[model samples]
Target: MATRVLLLMALTLYIFPIATATFHVKGSVYCDTCRAGFETNATFYIRGARVGIQCKERKTMKVAFYSEGVTDSTGTYHIEVENDHRDNICECLLVKSPIKWCSTPDSGRDKSSIVLTHYQNGIVNHLHYANAMGYLRDEPLPECHKLLKYYLADSDV
Candidate 1:
C-alpha cells in the first residue's frame, strides 16, 4: 500500500505540469495590398506589426489573460501563454500595422481564434497556431483590378 501510494504520487507530480503546460501561439500578419479581403500574389507580409493574444472567461466574458507581441522581419509573431484556459475563450488579435496606408484591420480577418489548453487539444509539443490575419489598404492598388481578375469567376474574369 505504501509503495502504491508513492508511485501514484510520483505519477501525479510528473503529469500535473504537463497538463498545465505553457503554449506558444505562432502566427503571421500581412498587408492586403490590393484591399481584396484575402491574400493574393500582391499580399505583403508586414514587419514590425503589433499583435496580441487575449483570453476571456467563457461565462462572464471577463478578460482572463492578455499578452502582446510584434511581428519579426518575416512577419511572424510568437507569443507564449502560460496555464491552461480550457473554459476560456482565446484569440490572436491584430493590434497595429506599421504601414500608414495599411493600418485598417481587415473586417473579417482581424483575429484568429485559438485553443490554449494542451489537455483537450492533444498537442504534445504545446505549440498552437492561429490563422494568419491581415490589414487592409486605404485604397486598392492601381493594378489590383487586373490582378483580382484571376480570383473571379469565369464570367467576371
Candidate 2:
C-alpha cells in the first residue's frame, strides 16, 4: 500500500507541470507618422513603447490581472501569461509610446483580444499574436492627404 501511494505521488508531480503550461504573447508597436489610418512608407515601428495586458472577470467584469511591457529595439513586446484565464477575457492594450510627437492611440484600433488559456486549444507552448498598435502623429503629414486620396478614389469606384 505504501509503495502504491509513493508511485502515485511521483506520477502527479511529473504530470502537474506538464498540465499547467504557460503561453507566450507577442506583438509590436508602431508610429503612424502619416495618420493615414494604416501603415505606409512613412510609418515606423517604435521602440520603448509601453503596452500591457488587462484580464477581466467574465461574470462581474472586474479586472483580474494586469502586466506591463515595453517594446524592444525592433518594436516587439513579448509577454507570458502563466495563469489560465479561460473564465475571463484579456486584451493587449496600448499604454504609451516614447515618441512624444506620435503618442495617441488611433481610434477603433487601440486594443486586441487574446486567448491565453489552454482551455480553447490544448496546445502547449502556445503563441498568441496581437495586431500591431500605433500612435497617431501630432499632425498629419502633408503627403498623407495625397496618399489617402488614392485610396479614397479606389473606394469610390
Candidate 3:
C-alpha cells in the first residue's frame, strides 16, 4: 500500500504544470550611425524598418524562436514575447530597408535589419539608421546614455 501511495504522489508531481509570468520588450528606432532620430520627411515613399526578436537555447546555443516588428515614422517600436529560461538568451534586431543612398555598402544597408540584445521592457530609440554613404548600420550609438546603451544590452532569461 505504501509503495502504491508513493508511486501516485510521484506521478502527480510529474504531471503538474509549471507557471511563469510574461514580460514585455519595447524600444524606439533610429539611424545606425548618426544616432539621429528618424521621422517621416518629404520622402513619404520610404517605408519604416522592421525589427526582429530571437531566442537562443541555453545549452545548445542555437536559435529556438524568431518574431518580427515594424517601426513607426517617428522611429518607435514595441514588441511582446514570451520569456525563456534564466540561461536562455534574447535579442532584438533591425532587418530590411527600402532607400538607395541609405542602402550603401559601408552604410551596412541591405533591407533594414538591426540586431539588439540585452534590453527588455524599456525604451530603445533611434539606435538604427543609414549613414551618409547610403549603407545601413543597425546598432546603437557608442554613448553611455541610458537609451543608447540598451542597443547592446542582451538578457539571459
Candidate 4:
C-alpha cells in the first residue's frame, strides 16, 4: 500500500504541467553619427547601436529585469529573452538621434517591423512598422492629406 501511494504521487507530479509567463526584451536600432531614425529615408542603417530591455509587471506595475546590448554596423540591437510575466509591456526607442529634433513614431500605435517574441526565445527579424501613413515617403505632404486623421492622432514622439 505504501509503495502504491508513492508511485501515484510521483505520477501526478510528472503529469502536471508547469505554467510560466513570458516577458519581452526589446529596443530600437539607430546610427551613431547621424542620430536620425535608422533606415528612415533610404535604408537607414545602424551599425553597432545599443539595445536594452526593461521588464515590468502588468497588474501590480513592477519592474523585474533590465539588460542592454550593442548593435553591429547594421544598427541592429539585441537582448536576452525576458522570462515569466505576460502582463509586462516591452519597448525599444532610439536613444540618441543624429538629429535631435527629428520626429518619432507614436508609441503603442505606429507599427514598425520591430522584432517581437511571445513566450519564446528567438530573434524575430523584420517585424515591419505600421501606422497612419503606410511608410516614410519623400512625396509632398499634401499628397497624403487624406491620411491626416491617422497620423495626427497622439504620437509617441
Q: In candidate 2, residue 83 scores what lDDT?
A: 76
Query: Per-residue lDDT tens digits of candidate 1, residues 66-154?
Result: 99999999999999998888889999999999899999999889999999875544555678889999999998889989888867856
The local distance difference test score of model 4 is 0.40
lDDT per residue as tens, model 2, 23-93: 78999888887887787877889999999999999999999989989999999999887777878889999
**lDDT for model 1:** 0.90
TM-score of each: 0.85, 0.81, 0.45, 0.41
TM-score head-to-head 1 vs 4, winner = 1
Candidate 4 RMSD computed on C-alpha atoms after optimal superposition onto the true structure? 10.1
Per-candidate clashes come to 0, 0, 38, 24
Clashing pairs in 2: none
Q: Scored by CA lDDT, what does every candidate get?
A: 0.90, 0.84, 0.47, 0.40
Better of 2 and 4 by TM-score: 2
The 10-residue segment of model 1 with minimum total lDDT is 12-21
Q: Which stretches of candidate 2 lie over 4 Å from their true place?
A: 1-19, 120-125
- Candidate ranking under TM-score, highest first, comes to 1, 2, 3, 4
Best by lDDT: 1
Candidate 3 regions exceeding 4 Å error are 1-18, 32-47, 104-157
Reference-based lDDT, residue 41, model 3 = 26
